[model samples]
Target: MSTFKAPKGTYDLIPPVSETFLAVREALAAPLRRAGYGYVETPGFESVELFARGVGESTDIVTKEMYAFTTKGGDELALRPEGTASVLRAALEANLHKAGNLPVKLWYSGSYYRYERPQKGRYRHFSQVGAEAIGAEDPALDAELIILAVDAYKSLGLRTFRLLLNSLGDKECRPVYRAALQDFLRGLDLDDDTRRRIDINPLRVLDDKREAVQKQLTGAPMMRDHLCEACKTYHEQVRELLTAAGVEFEDDPKLVRGLDYYTRTTFEFVHDGLGSQSAVGGGGRYDGLSEMIGGPELPSVGWALGVDRTVLALEAEGVELHVPASTQVFTVALGEEARRTLFGVVTELRRAGVPTDFAFGGKGLKNAMKSANRSGARYAIVAGERDLAEGGVQLKDLQSGEQAPVALGEIVAELRRKLV
Candidate 1:
């Protein structure tokens, strides 16, 4: 092993297992693609202020978990701890919303960084597939995103996960709820740090998971109770739409999420089997985020499904993803001349859209066949000097142990036929 390892809270995605992660990401993004959401990519790091202001400075993600640093140029930068803020910043900077589109739909898949005490289902470096609908505030837009997420999870055969939903009243009524929540939180026996959170963002204090904190928060005011008539109607419409579409969700009164940007509709996808870190993915509306980062007012809604956590959820439910074999056909060449000829054949097979691999380093037939077996390929082509002289190559079906021969020029066509 090399003397170095992936940084303490990070991981390497190796084969077999890595294939599952890829499948999970593709599954999550498929619905977004079909929904007219274009792909978006952002830098791994951005100005620290973008997050401090957009993600809410009082949130743990900004103050404690953010991987922030001051560059040699005296510029402060931080590896993104989440996707929403960075994505919105990019959309605003590029003026995508001004392109005559009411909601610029975009989807993204990448790794996000955070500084946290890593544990099962929680890591400093993790993968996520996110979607954002910028410049819209309709409840149907929120319902649409939720439906798309549910479809993605269902497409992966995940059934035990639950969608927990809540509405964190928008600017009109959030202030009223915030004050009420802060008043209730202050009466609890909280630490100095948590007490300070009461002043900055008391909703975050309600997200506290500590047993001592939980015990004291029994009577805390819920956002549902404080929602204004507009927010209440909007929340009800979202719920009604989700139900009409057959997406079942439990109404969570205190689902504030970890970020401070979330306003109005907040939700989380949780798998009961995931233990303490049950949230596989979640996101919600951030109506004021655009203005928070010095952009025009653009109400947006989005969700990011955790690729790592989704894989864990799959395993927890004992669901097997149908990851296709990387190599569909393996070629074993005997002699140097046979290697050259078979190498050309391999290239031809690949050009013909066959997933083919060749045995390199000139191993003996036995070792080469062993490699072919381990490749998970359905078929193997073996060519020796004698076989090449005869103008044919031996073809073996790895699954049934059937062997035959096909003309050298016809091998690619033969494999393609059998594969189909």
Candidate 2:
């Protein structure tokens, strides 16, 4: 025998559990769809320069985690590490900014890749449901994205999550803070890699999770303290709007986010039950992202909800999603004549919007009945040579053990009425 297995970082989603994943994705996108967010689809991979320019040169996503490769055409491309950059690039390519709408809203759901050590809530490949509202920089737009994200989680019955909010000042005041922060970080004892980061992007030093770095960062200059008047008012208005919308959030000064393009308001929905990797979904305002990637200066706010992590959160909180079974009607036929007739009946039933399946391989009465019972179908259509000759079919209620005979022509209507 040959030894074969799935890739180390990926798992095939199969059966009853896969239904739950689909349900979760739909639930997360429902509110966005209701709020005029049109669906947007993007390729799994994009130009390496798109991420390198948009995500930031010093961030782990581009510098270390991205899955970059040179194609046969000598093009440098990579499997998208996140959603916002690609979404912005797509909107730019399509020239959605020229459509005259202030904010072109869009929703997307797909897989994202990152070369991280696989753990409980982190994986090399994971699914995400994301939404973006571009071409607007108003605080209300920021609040709208946050509200939609909150509604998505609540719609999924996720209660044990908290929203962490912050503001990374935009062009007006960020330079001053960056300079002061760089001066502070330079005095500390850091390794060569971190020291190099201090020059490329000093804000990343704030996101470092190492206990040693965090210990020295206790006195680091905070963005909230140095926010310019416009940024301060923008962050305050976002807070006020979120509160008016009845969305509770905690002010987290350390929440600088992991991206370079993020400016003004930033937030994250974290589930404490997930231990170290707690973020279930998060996004913020990217006021300069479009121009950073060579597009016009279009601002956007969005978030990507982690399907795998959200499922883990549900399990952690003992929540089970209500997903319907695959088959609603199971057909059992004996003999060649009955098989031919019932096959047509099954096809008609499916065409009428009934989820129906049939027993194949000519199984006998006892075995076919067992298979029908195991299918989780509400009713079983049982027919044999005797019933076929009589122009009738036996519709058996699998749960009640009751049987009734109906005219062959009336079977589809009967099942549809009962199933409905």
Candidate 3:
């Protein structure tokens, strides 16, 4: 046996399974593209401070899960644990916000790293499909992002996931709400770590999944009740837009997302059937993220859906993503003379936009046809020494089990006319 593997907490995506991943990415990004979001690609790793500031130092992403290391140049860098921060950093560095576009719309598909205890849907390394609309504070943008996500899921035939919505309130009201939350948290019997969370980011305490912490938090102060007038209006407008658009959502006061930068609007998508790791994806408005990362004050909203988790959710609901079959034609040749001649014809067929494949081994005609059948090819092109000598070949329709002898010079046009 080989002494190497894909490393713990990480899995290889191969073949048919990879097709599912591609399908999910396409389903999610298709709507974003239509909505004016151009594709963006950022490096897999960035300076550690980018996330520390953009994602919030107090959050588990930075404090615990991030895979950070000092490079040979003494620069601290981390593989992105999430997509939004790096995308935001790229936007900031490129002066995308200053490009006069009110919202620099972009979509990305990539992998993320986190030192998590490996589980069904959670991994030390995972893939994500995220979208960001930067430089905007409009409630419609918030609602639009959410609607895009919902549409993406629906288009993928997913039905088991539920949308969770919340507002953390803007800067004007969040401080007051944090103070109230702190007062309540301090009174609870919490561990040292929980207490530290109170000082660094009291809102994160609301994200505690422990039974005891959740019980103690049942009567805690709610941020929604303390929202400032402006935040309340913004949140309300977001809700109104979603409602008017007929997007279903549940208002969750406890959805104070784990990230520290999220302000005003926070949301999560959960699959009820996924057991403990039910959150398939989520994101929110991070109005202070730019300033936190030492950039100008630019508000941004976005979401990252777990491609793995989404695939699991689809599986849980028995939703099969229909990945189209690999190609239309398979070419089979017998003897060296025929093989050489057919190889050129195969190349020409492919160049002419035909999805074609050819047998590699010098197999007998029967075995070649068998290979063609296994390849899911709709048609098979067979050429033997005799056919090569006669200036023609045979075309067989695998579906109809019918064959026709055609002139060699006319095969390409015949295939094109029949296949198209």
Error of 2 at 99 (Å): 1.9
Cα lDDT of model 3 by residue, 108-211, tens digit: 99989999899889899999899999988899999999999999999999987889999998878888888999999999999999999999999888889999
TM-score for each model: 0.99, 0.97, 0.97
Could you tell which candidate, 1 or 3, scores higher by lDDT? 1
Single out the weakest 10-residue window by summed lDDT for candidate 3. Answer: 361-370
Please give, for residues 292-377, the per-residue lDDT of candidate 2 as tens digits.
99988888898889999999999999999988878999999988899999999999999999999999888998999899888889
> What range of 10 consecutive residues in model 1 has the weakest lDDT sum?
181-190
Best by lDDT: 1
Q: Model 2 clash pairs?
A: none
For model 2, the superposed segments whose C-alpha errors exceed 4 Å read: none
Worst 10-residue lDDT window, candidate 2: 1-10
Q: What is the lDDT of residue 77 in candidate 3?
A: 97
List the global CA lDDT of all models.
0.93, 0.92, 0.91
